[model samples]
Target: MPSPSPILLAPMEGLLDFVLRDVLTRIGGVDRCVSEFIRITGTVLPDRVFLRYVPELLNGSRTPAGTPVRPQLLGSDAACLADNAAALARLQPEGVDLNFGCPANIVNRHGGGAALLDTPEALFDIVRAVRAAVPAHLPVSAKMRLGVRDASLALENARALAEAGACELVVHARTKTDGYRPPAYWELIAAIREAVAIPVVANGEIWTVADAQRCRELSGCQALMLGRGAVADPGLAWAIRAADGQAVSGAVGWTELLPQLDAFWRIISHHFPGRQRVGRLKQWLNLLRRRHPEAEAAFMEIRTLTDPAAVDAWMARQRA
Candidate 1:
């Protein structure tokens, strides 16, 4: 029998920040997490910039739940990214991950993220440079999509990253053109896995235990990285593990999630300003409604709330 695969928490830039990472990891079952990408432009960023994006660096690069978080860097400049990676390595992160998969228009227009897929050689240079900059003991991993417009160069891009010293790869299973649509082509991930020597993790459109099973079967990858699905259902990782015969608890229902929601509210309230606090809670509640019917009612209750005190009152009512 093969060993059970590691389940990773994906880096979702505005959606999943340090606060949510803390909340979800506390719910248990995620093996590791990648912090939201810290965009590297033409200059090397300071340690504070990396810390701002991944405060886990200050906690020995692990969340409060002790789950390791590898910071991800997104940019097109090989030299600048390497310099920043070297600076980030000085803080002694668990590892560094490159982002070649973001589909955001602003990111692609800047010659970063999914746009790099159009030029596999650039991917190779970026990875090779960062790999050389970071210490040998620290792993250099990467995440990428099939391509900007299609899956034509998926295997070539995967091979380029692996050959350039990326220790692992996460394939999002969709192109920039796909843009979070249905029917993520898991079969294409299988081919990329066969072409690469390092471990490959399957990602994109996995929302349930059944989806997890089918993706693993089709992609032939034991590992997976959960994104929107995990946000919608925080218990997803544990549920998937339970289905895999692991000695873990099963799916977390609405009642069990209430306290986690409260904890999330408290953190955001303290860290974010009034408007942002409301927006962040609404953002999460919006996604949670997909998995929990109760969230729909909860969302409606607070949909009209624009003041922080009113949101607090709403939270208090939920607790009551």
Candidate 2:
């Protein structure tokens, strides 16, 4: 093929924060990373909040490893979003991403995230406003689900975002109601790709290289964004890239990943408290276990441990 194509790290709230983004993107093959959703409420949030969400904005909008970080905004009010986008633009992000795809009940109840799918006009207006507010050089992208309850508005929603000047869009290939059920409906992305002229990135249900190839063929989307799968298999992007092109024999096995795990623990413990670090490490370890037998064995060793120091010691032993 013409090249493996660009892979983006999805903005998964709570899970893929700056720390995770820093660790994961460092593995390579990921072109860019979007920040955890910056919750825009009734008014424009201050710069500190944006900085808190995307610390990389201060570092040339890049991870320590050099992957560009795009800040994602989530909310319903067009004016509030636009105003916040303007403030974010001042901070010089690579781009501003709008989140219309989050399925969290808390987000929807607060008139943010997938709730906007119910009112396509509001989604359009929000995009239009943010697009107008940000500098012309900066890109304005959007992420959305197929629809709220069904695929009924998929085309309309895609068209609305494209018409409102979303230079690129990422479709999660499922309705808000699907809530990550089996079968990500990759075919739905094809209709979205056809509906909009801007680049349509296919997301959801891509857990392996084979799945990536199938998603590319099925969605007809050159760009693919990875979420949980990337977390579970840190070397997945490299493996996928190698499968299509030059061989990348980097960090595939669990033993090979121990150093990375230790690096993550040392980096995160500097900021997160012992209990929070314990929880975060386990959260990642749980996801990691899905792909690596080593992670499963490691999790079993630390599953009941509530102290970060104990967890650190366990990881040190693994390294030894």
Candidate 3:
């Protein structure tokens, strides 16, 4: 039988930085990850910015756990995006991804991100320019929503990206206006798959192994990307693999999970200090609470704490 479709860790800005990417991919079953976009604005970004967003690039573009990391760029100017893509390419990243799907009001208002979806021609131009700028061998991809305000242009946008030389496409299954409200319109993905020649990866609202199977069946996609769900349940991808008749990895209970949390704390502490690190931990725990009642209780205990080392002590006590 053919290998099971790969499960990718979706890029959630402000949340899925190198620390989370390393931690989650280390848990197993993630095939790869995309960096939280590096905004191109009107000029090429400095090299340090790329390094900061995707440090793995310096180490062969793979996370410490060995999953490949694709560096993504977001901007509206075709030439500018292409320029930045070329600069990122020089870093020898595993791949390049273009972002046409950010839903933040600030991004859209600035004529970047999902705003480009309003004009498919602009999307095609940007992707085409970047495609031509990068060498032929490197795989280029795009991630987009159904549309800015509706799903009317879903197929057109998908076609635009493919025709522009995007090797793969990931559809978030919601309109920009939908803003993650769910019922991800998986059916629309099937139509998009039919319209595009390249591979389609389904994303959005996938919360369980059952959900993953249902998304594959409904969207006719060959691969899947997990965002909040992966953060909530780190074992989600492995569970999906096991359900597909693959060998199962061991499960992670709260006891096993606490160490991973501690690892995350240590990783963040290396970069952030004091209350900043504690705040980052709270952000992760808030997401983890969805899957682990233990996380919810732990969050309540540390949510008000201000010191980073103090929070680490609390976690160490729990682990003990």
Candidate No. with top TM-score = 1
Worst 10 residues of 2 by lDDT: 1-10
On a 0 to 100 scale, what is the lDDT of residue 137 in model 2?
100
Off by over 4 Å in 1: 1-3
Winner by lDDT: 1
- Over 169-277, each residue of candidate 3 has an lDDT whose tens digit, in order, gives 9999998999989789887899999998998899999998888988989999869999999999988888888888888767766776777898998888898878888
RMSD of each: 1.5, 1.7, 1.5
Tens digit per residue, CA lDDT, model 1, 1-320: 22369999999989999999999999978899999999998888888889889999999999999999999999999999999999999999989999999999999999999999999999999999999998899999999999999999999999999999999999999999998899899989999999989999999999999999999999999999999999999999989988888887656999989999999999998899999999999999999999999999999999888899998888898899
Tens digits of lDDT, candidate 2, 12-91? 98899998898887677788888889998888888999998899989999999989999999998899999999999999
Off by over 4 Å in 2: 1-4, 247-251
Clashing pairs in 1: none
Question: Higher lDDT: candidate 1 or 2?
Answer: 1
**TM-score for model 1?**
0.98
Between which residue pairs do clashes occur in model 3?
none
